[model samples]
Target: MPPHSLLELHDITREYSLGKSRVNALRGVDLSVSAGEFTVVTGPSGSGKTTLLNIIGCLDRATSGSYRLDGEEIGDRDFDALAEVRNRKVGFIFQSFNLIPVLDVAENIELPCRLREEGGRNQRALRARVEALADAVGLRPYLHHKPDELSGGQRQRVAIARALITEPRLVLADEPTANLDSATSQHILDLMLRLNREQGVTFLFSTHDPRVVAHAWRVLHIQDGKLLSGEYPGVSRRASGAS
Candidate 1:
C-alpha cells in the first residue's frame, strides 16, 4: 500500500448474477489514489466507469477484493457500517446536484454535520466551517438562497461545499458536469481544481466528458471493467471523439 493513500483497491471485482450467467462490472481492478490528488476516470457508456466510482464511494460493495479507505479496510463491512463510513469519511457530489429544493444554500451545506451530529455538538463551529467553505466556493452571497433561486453553477458549488462539510478524506463525483452547459462546466471544474490545490481535498470523479478529463492532473482510463495504463489525454478503446 502506498503511504497516506486515501483510497486503495486490490483485485476488486463485481459480478452480477444474470439468471445463470454472470456479468462482470469490475474485474481485478487495482488502483491507488493519494490524498490531495485530483484524478478522473474516463470511459465509454458501458465501460464500468460508474461501477468503479460506486465501489470507491462505498455506495456498493465488490464481489471480491480488498478496499482500503483512509487507511482502514472496509470492503467486508456490512451495509450499516458502510453507511457510517460514507457519512464519516466519504462525500458525494452527483451530476444532478442533489440539493433539497426547499433548503437554502447554508442549510444544504450544513446538512452533513446535522446528519452526523458530530463536531462536539457545536453548532457555532459547524456554522463557521460552512461559511468558510461557502466563501471558498464563492457562495457566501447566495447562502440564504434556495436551489431554484441559484444558477446551475451556483447549485453545483453548493453541492461541493456540502461534500466538504464532513471534512472527508475523499470526494466522489459521478459525472458532475453532465448537467451543466459547456461554459458552466468549465467554471465548475476550475472551482473544483482550485479546491483540490488550496484545501488539499482529494477528488475522484467519473465522466465521459473529454473537457472534464482534460482538466485532470491525473487521468485514468477504464474499459470493460479494467484499468488501462497509457499516456492520456487519449481516449480508451471504448471512447470516441471526445465524449
Candidate 2:
C-alpha cells in the first residue's frame, strides 16, 4: 500500500463459481488510490473493471488477497459487516442514477443520510444540508419535483448530490454517465470535476468513456482480469482541453 492511500488492494482476486465451472473476475490486481485524487479505471466489457471496483467499494468481497479501505483491512469481513463499513465509508453512483421515482430531488439527495444512525432524529439539520446540496447541484428549482419531472442531466446531478450527502471519504461511480447523451455526459463530468476540485472529495470511477478518462488525473487500465498499462495517461483538462 502506498503512503496515505485511502484505498489499497494488494494482489486482489475474485472468483465466481458456477455449478460446474469457475470464473475468474480479477487476477492479482493491485491498486492504490490516495485521498482527494480523481482516478478512473478503464476497461472493455467483461474485463474485470466493475469487479475490481465492486471489491474496492466493499460491495463484493475478494476471494484472495488483502484489501484496505480508509486504513482498515477489510478483505476478511462477512457480508453484513462489509455493508456497514461501506455505508459509512463510501458513496456510490451507478449507471442508472438509481433515484427513487416518487421522492423529490431533495428527498432523494437526503436518502443516504436518512439511513444513517440518528438520521431521523436530526431531520432538521439533514434537511438543511440537503437543500444546500440541491442548490450546489443547480437543482434548487426542482427540489420538490419528482424524478419524472427532471431531464437526464438533472437526474444525474441529483445522483451526484445524493452520493455526497454523507460527506464520505470516497465516492465510487460505475459508468455514471453511461445512460446520458454526449452533451449531458459532458455536463455531468464537469459537475463531478468541479466538486472534486472544490471539495477535495476523492473520486474513483470505472468507465469505458474516453471523455471521462480524459479528465482523470490518474488512469488505471484493466484487461483480461489483470491491470495493464495503456496510453490513457497524460490526459487532463490541460492535456486535452476536456472539462
Candidate 3:
C-alpha cells in the first residue's frame, strides 16, 4: 500500500449462493483510495457497485481477497470485529434515508455518538457539534421536526449530518440522491462537495446518477462483475474546487 492510501483492495472477489447456483458479484477487483478522495463507482444494476461498497464499508466480507483499511488488514475479521471497525472508522448514507421515524432531526443526527458504549462523551460538546452540522446542512430550522414531517431532501440532509457526526475516516454513500427531485439532488450534491473540499472528507459513492458522477474527483466504472478501464481522475477537479 502507498503511504497515503486509506483503503487498498487486492484481487477482491465476492460470491453468493443463490438457490442452487453461485453468483459472482465481483471478479478480481483491485482498488486503492487515498485519504480525502471524492470518488464514485458507477455501474449498471447488478454490476457489483453495492457489493463493492459493502465490502469497503465493512458491512460484508469479500469471498476472496485482501482488504486493508488505514493499513490494517481487515478482510478476515469476524463479524464483531468488523462491526467495531465499521462503527469507529466508517459512516454510511443509504438511498432510503434510514432515519428513525420517531426521532427528530437533531436526535437522528446525534444518534451515532450516543450508540457508542464507552459513555464518556461530553454532552455539551456533542450537542454543539450536532447543531453545527445541522446548520451546515440547512436543517437547523427543522431540528425539532421528525422524519415524517420533513421533505425527502430534508430527511436526506439529516442522514448526511448523522453520517458526519461520527467523524469517521471514510463515508460510503449508495445512491444517496435516488429518492430526491432533480433540484434537491443537486442541492445534496453541492453540500457534499462543499464538505469534501472544506473538511477533506473522503467519500466513496455507488451511484447511477450522472450529475453525481460529473462532480467526482475520480470515477471507477465496473461491469459484469469486472472493472472496465475507465478509472481516471475526472476533469471537474479544478472546476469543482477540489484540492
The TM-score leader among the candidates is 3
Top candidate (lDDT): 3
**Candidate 2, run of 10 with poorest lDDT:** 234-243
- Model 3 off-target regions past 4 Å? 1-3, 118-120, 233-243
Clashing pairs in 2: none
Model 1, global lDDT: 0.86
**Comparing 1 and 2 by lDDT, which wins?**
2
Q: Please identify which of the two predictions, 2 or 3, would achieve the higher lDDT against the true structure.
A: 3
Model 3 global lDDT (CA atoms, 0 to 1): 0.90
Q: What is the TM-score of each candidate against the true structure?
A: 0.90, 0.93, 0.94
Question: Superposing all C-alpha atoms, what RMSD in Å does each candidate have to the true structure?
Answer: 5.2, 2.8, 2.1
User: Looking at candidate 1, what is the lDDT of residue 32?
Assistant: 88
Question: In model 3, how large is the Cα lDDT of residue 188?
Answer: 97
* Residue-by-residue lDDT tens digits, candidate 3, 19-133: 9999999999999888988889998999999999999999999999999999899999998999889989999999999999988998889888888842255888888999999
Select the stronger candidate by TM-score from 1 and 2: 2
Model-by-model lDDT, in order?
0.86, 0.87, 0.90
Off by more than 4 A, model 1: 1-3, 230-243
User: How well is each residue in 160-194 modelled by candidate 1, as lDDT tens digits?
Assistant: 99999999989999999999999999989888877
